[model samples]
Target: MHSRSLLSPLARAALLLALLLATAPAMAWGRLGHRLVAQLAWDGMTPAARAAALDLLQDEPDPSLAGVANWADELRANDPGLGRRSASWHYVNLAEDGCHYDVARDCPRGNCVVAAIEAQAAILADPARPREDRVKALKFVVHFVGDVHQPLHAGFAHDKGGNTVQVNLDGRGSNLHALWDSGLLEQAGRDEAQWLEHLRGLPLRQGAGLGPSDWAEASCRIVRSPGFYPGRAKIDEEYGLQWSATASRQLRLGGEHLARVLNGALGG
Candidate 1:
């Protein structure tokens, strides 16, 4: 008969190490829900827009495309079922909450991403700047444009925009911020391309009906929704039934608006 004590200490250590290795990628990239936006930026835009997007993306000190790509590749290699959309939730939350200069307080009214976008506009508007520099400026604008659309990126003063609100997602213990970051998007079971296609099909209006301030306000409106966490005690059940759909719709709308603004900004 096999005994529990039959395994050596080295064998146990090896098993533990292997398990950790298996789970590490999920822990890293699974939580980084913003990969979809980056992927879309890289794939969906025009060549000039893509270049501009890359320039804008450089504002984030970490979480670069290469870093996310490596993390994603590792996760996919380990688990073929892991989809790129899995990262959108984390990305939205990170953009909203993590972009803040102060974790203890609300994000500054004009944050880094906002500032970067405005700066890019200035560069793009400059007549004397070279085409190369203008392209670089446009890249930053494209990236930051996507960033601001993430509702969580425009977070609230309280709970660090849901980061401090702990809850369980589908019985998996997580935080409110985390739920918004990846939980709902993962539940959708669709890839980024599919999601983007859906977003593109949404009813979109034209001619400056929305702008940067409007984007910020829209996110804040969602973040401040009265029913956001109805019945605080039953957060998990409530989120499953109500908040998840809200988050999904918000993400879809955000992506659609992001594409619209980029197309307009680039004079497309």
Candidate 2:
């Protein structure tokens, strides 16, 4: 009877292991499983940059608006787990901590993403570091570059920047953050590349220009935009058109900003 009691714990462990293994494949999909945006950036790079970008992407691999739809489709095809988890809340903690700070607290708006990028930069620059660390850092840099482009991720502290504000997404109950993160991408449809191309064609804001600092500042401004809110629900045709346009503009800016940063970092 004592031996039987000891065996029960082992049996439970075996059951737990089996459950984890059964769900592992499903969990290995969507933005959480693979770094979709980082992969896209890596794939789109020149041969010289590709090698370095691969190293950067190893640590972080979340997708951007331009690639989320494609990533989602691939996730649906390859793993059932993608449907269960939402990547929208990955940066929620940053928003909660950084936004609405008086002079006392450090603002996370630009600092959070910057820290991640700097970590990658350090790994890339350090020759003594293990190759694995360099590789992981590069990947993290790639992923964080995309993160800084997300306006809500740069938002104010109050209300957790819309995470607390529940709303109906096309009549399906959801929240503001989810609507911005994946819903907007989903609405853009399956043709992510074409949509991205269209966005790239928009005229740049003259003299607005782009740099890492500029991008960060722009994101902060967007986060503070009056249009960004939780329960102020207005999904009319005009609102849809405006919001889509805004999202497209932001995506283009993000890609362009990422390209510039990579080019400068690689000394190209």
Candidate 3:
């Protein structure tokens, strides 16, 4: 009886995919990338850390440590209330005024990936907090750690972390941010486990005790580095060949550092 056009489930899903491809810029490390990072962290966790994490996840829909890696993102999609409130925690908008990362100017009111990670880490480390609270914090920590490591997530204000900057990948319409999110990784032609194994084989260059803010800045540095942001909007085989290596490195670092942070927080 309504005039509004209702799309079929498949059609609606296609529309959602398109919109998410455009708007899900802050889902740093993409679905596969986040899974890979969490899996590595789970694998590397000490017995005590694993026990602590498992204890908190007793009631989780996906109780396995890595299985709940996308808990925050899934929550964002399904729970509108908490989803809207926590959206900004995914990424910090670094103003284009040079390469400085002043917490006040870059990350105001503690609504950013770096600040969120630090806050959640503190919460998870606090044994006095309720189990539920710590479990939620653990999810955010797992996600935000991956977010800060995505070079485009720590993006400039001008282009909304390259979301506004249009580009092409393998002759398809896309944006700079989305390309790095899943486009680059999808081309790897391997499943998440294969990707994880490949990344684990790489040497991780962990900074000497870097914090969340430092991790964001590291991603920013990579963004500023040469051969990342294509001079032109359209990209092809050459660009992919060059930047896939950097993408791999970023994923590796994300997984490595996530393990370190969780290990430290859980007293591993």
Candidate 4:
């Protein structure tokens, strides 16, 4: 009574595997997303900014914006001391305040992403700072700019930015934060080049002189939107179809914003 029964043994096995994979939860943006953001920023940067960034990265292996885009994320494994110190710099919990970012209330010691972006941009802009320090700042700027754009990174503190909000995505277990971070984007099945091409087709709207706080606020608003957190703990195909566009838009916008930050700090 079933179509699968008509197939050969190997054919049915392949069909079953295909269905499983189609529903399997793939890792989202993660390194790939970061690199996409970095590459997009690099492609959008001014010639002067690119040159300055290159000079700063000359001493490193793989000296490109995309090359070091994930440095901060890997700091825990590569540089544990700095990693521990900067652990909180990647996000801010603002859902408690109606998605409003009050510097004093949200970021007490300049530890959150919004503050981190401002501080790193300042360091990158200062000509007198040690070159080594400035280089690190450059890397941080690239990574944090991308982080601030991720909705959950600017999401609620109650659930640790949705990291604890578990859900069943496709047929596998995942979390809300992970869904935004890389899962939704991964569902598109576009490689970096494909994503770049897709993003390039979208307009890079000019922000009205907005900065990191503004960016974080925007992401917070997305989290606060209706149904951002699914009522049921199950993520269906339609969920990815609906939210993937927002995630891609964020990645593109993150690229544009990172370029602006680098251009101002390094373009001289």
**Which candidate number maximizes TM-score?**
4
As a whole number from 0 to 100, the lDDT of residue 249 in candidate 3 is: 82
* Model 3 lDDT per residue over 1-268, tens place: 0111244544433443453355464466678888888887787789999998988888887787577778778876688788888888888766365556788987789888888998999999999998888988998899888888888888787888888778754344667787778766654455677687778887868775788877888788888887678888666544544677788888788888888888999999
Best by lDDT: 4
1-268, model 2: which lDDT tens digit per residue?
0011122444433432333223321121124212434433443455655555544444434323233323333433556574233232123233443343222243243334454455556666565788766654454455556666666656655655455565543333445655556444434342445544555466554242544444555666766666666335534223333466666566655555555555545543
lDDT, candidates in the order shown: 0.47, 0.46, 0.76, 0.81
Of the candidates numbered 2 and 4, which has the greater TM-score value? 4
lDDT of 1 at 43: 43
Model 4 TM-score is: 0.88
Stretches of candidate 3 above 4 Å error? Answer: 1-26, 169-171
Tell me the spans in candidate 1 whose CA falls farther than 4 Å from its real position: 1-112, 124-139, 169-172, 205-207, 264-267
Per-residue CA lDDT of candidate 4, range 146-201, in tens?
99988888888989888788777435666777667665655565668877888877
RMSD values, in order shown: 12.6, 15.2, 8.6, 6.1
RMSD of 2: 15.2
Q: Give the TM-score of candidate 3.
A: 0.87
lDDT assessment of candidate 1: 0.47
TM-scores for all candidates?
0.55, 0.61, 0.87, 0.88
What ordering of candidates by lDDT runs from best to worst? 4, 3, 1, 2
User: RMSD of candidate 3 to the true fold?
Assistant: 8.6
Candidate order by decreasing TM-score:
4, 3, 2, 1
